[model samples]
Target: MSTASDYLSRLISFDSVSRNSNEPVSDCVAAWLQELNFEVERTTYVDPRGVRKCNLLARRDPIAAQEQTLASGTGGLAYFCHTDTVTADRWTGPGGNPFHAVFENGRIYGRGACDMKGSLAAMLDAAQSISLADQMRPLWIVCTADEEVGFEGAQYLVDHSAAFRDLASLDPVSIIGEPTRLSVIHAHKGIVGMRIRSQGKAAHSSTDMGINANVAMVPMLQTLLEIDEQCRTDETLRNDAFDPPTLTWNFGVSDEMKTVNIVPDHCTAWASMRTMPGVDGREIVERVRRRAEELGLSFDLYSGGDPMHTDRDAPFVKELCELAEPYIGANEPHAVCYATDGCVLGELNRRIVCGPGGIAQAHTSDEFIEIEQLENGVRFYQDAIRHWCC
Candidate 1:
């Protein structure tokens, strides 16, 4: 019988960096669920070399035996949590290894410990504590891979599953257990991360035959600045739930093609757009594309994670609010600028992002989750199951 803290520590110890396969952690979760009498489903996504990465789903039905008593109209709930964390970089410190789980000063320090795996542990602990014989609706626990790189695992699950075909009729509600500091999040902005490449002929610096990629980037930067301003000032697009009303854009990565004496032949800039709820992401991309064409630049754009929202007054939201009351004090429904796996699940059911740790602690150096919060999360999940699923 592993406690939530014990499970979280074990989970954090596995080096499931987003760039690396999460097979180790995913396999451990599969085995644990199988031991709990769940019928586990493992969906594998193979790399070119034939190495397999996976997303695990476990299903349990208390109503299976009570079929005559429960009837066909009974519905269920789904829980989603990610199994990957970002790559530990220079910011993670000299001695920092994101895979190492250290418990000190009432907190557990590690990479995924706070960003997500903590919530996964809490969900598992809660499920194990409750007796399936008393539950009314079925329970689906899904541990998805590749959430950090992109939500590929979740996308595969939703696109390839017949179980999710009639999701609205089956599990009408979904809880994506992100680190929300116990708040119930009903809405969040969308994001599209893309790269734009600029090409020019190479020439000696003395000969002005080559175009400087850095110089070519000026107009694109200016256009993005204009778009950012519009995102800030648009009244209808603004929402108070987020700190700054509208969306924001930033150039996250950039690289110039060459050395000091050579005029570079090409330059590439990677940019990301955080779109507001009412704004159309495709429209924004098109506007950028138009600007790039006018500037005689060739660009490549990739888009994903569209804006999503669930009704604030839905039964699931209400249930979450009631459960979070004692711990977080009358939780207020709100929106966030950061994106989560909820966008995909939103298409299936009414999805809400809620959990124990604060987003501030996520993806930070010496990242840690308070032990008290982890304990509270276990109880919160247990109560949610008892009140709603049972």
Candidate 2:
């Protein structure tokens, strides 16, 4: 009997931060789906910090023949959402707790209210409204963990889940519930995070016997700047759909000796790149690697995800656009600069990023979602489910 707002309030109450366990939220979602007669599957994995995170896959298959259907290549539609939110230490809302969902001024204020939990609530309500007898195919509701950190939960599902394996064979269609303001998103930039390190001999600063690793890092930093400049000015890498239409880099963190008097033997710079689709991330890394070699420094490519782009002309894209036009009006499909689990899910199936709320409201100090947008999202998902599932 819980409404979408009630469900969202419950979801936001859980502190499913990227660094913490998402099991609490996952458990709540599973219980809700069970009430709706869904056969839920929970996948648990231990993170690097040994916290147990979970991914929930709930399906509405009354006849219990989804496995065969999926194996035969007619996979059902899936609504994908991430359960984790970014950690917030600077909350300015009334309750002074990011986990406390506050309803005020026609908006819901809380952590994850706009970033994702809003869409999760809408999806749950939409599924609840669907009649099992009207369903022509299986319907899946997926909640993943660690999406704010990386696509860890999605990756785990892809690697280990039998349901995912079956769906991959069928090439299922997925709707990723990211905060896209109800606009259809068919493309997004990828991410590459790396660390550049320089090593040298350590000694007293006053003595001429030591080499400063910080000094050695200067040329490498310059190289990174030059590479960034090239990416910015290069027309070939530009995609007009994106706002900036060029690769962007952030050299955000640097580590060196604590004391000014001691000669630093090692310096490390942590940086990341946002790459356009069709551009080779490896080539970009190699460009930096070659420069590091020229400067006689060692580097490590830590982690990365490929860019995602579904063709706007795809059948599913057209159908979704048509289905959403009446509710959200006619908004052309677009690209975003931010990354999502769609970057990973797109590899297995046709994926579109569309949901309630705006990216501007996400992860902010006073994160909130307009109540109207939340209600519209619920209606849109209900109609979408009817269109795709029934």
The 0-to-1 C-alpha lDDT of every candidate, in the order given, reads: 0.78, 0.83
Give residue 247's error in model 2 in angstroms.
1.1
In model 1, pairs of residues that clash are none
Best by TM-score: 2
Q: What are the per-residue Cα lDDT tens digits for candidate 2 across 1-104?
A: 77889999999999998999999889889999999988888889998899999998777764545556545567667889999999889888768999999999
**All candidates: CA RMSD in angstroms?**
2.5, 2.2
Q: Which ten residues in a row have the lowest lDDT in candidate 2?
A: 62-71
Error of 2 at 87 (Å): 1.3
lDDT, candidate 2, residue 189?
Answer: 90
Q: TM-score of predicted model 1? A: 0.91
Instruction: Write candidate 1's Cα lDDT for 170-207 as tens digits.
Output: 75467889999888898887778767777777789899
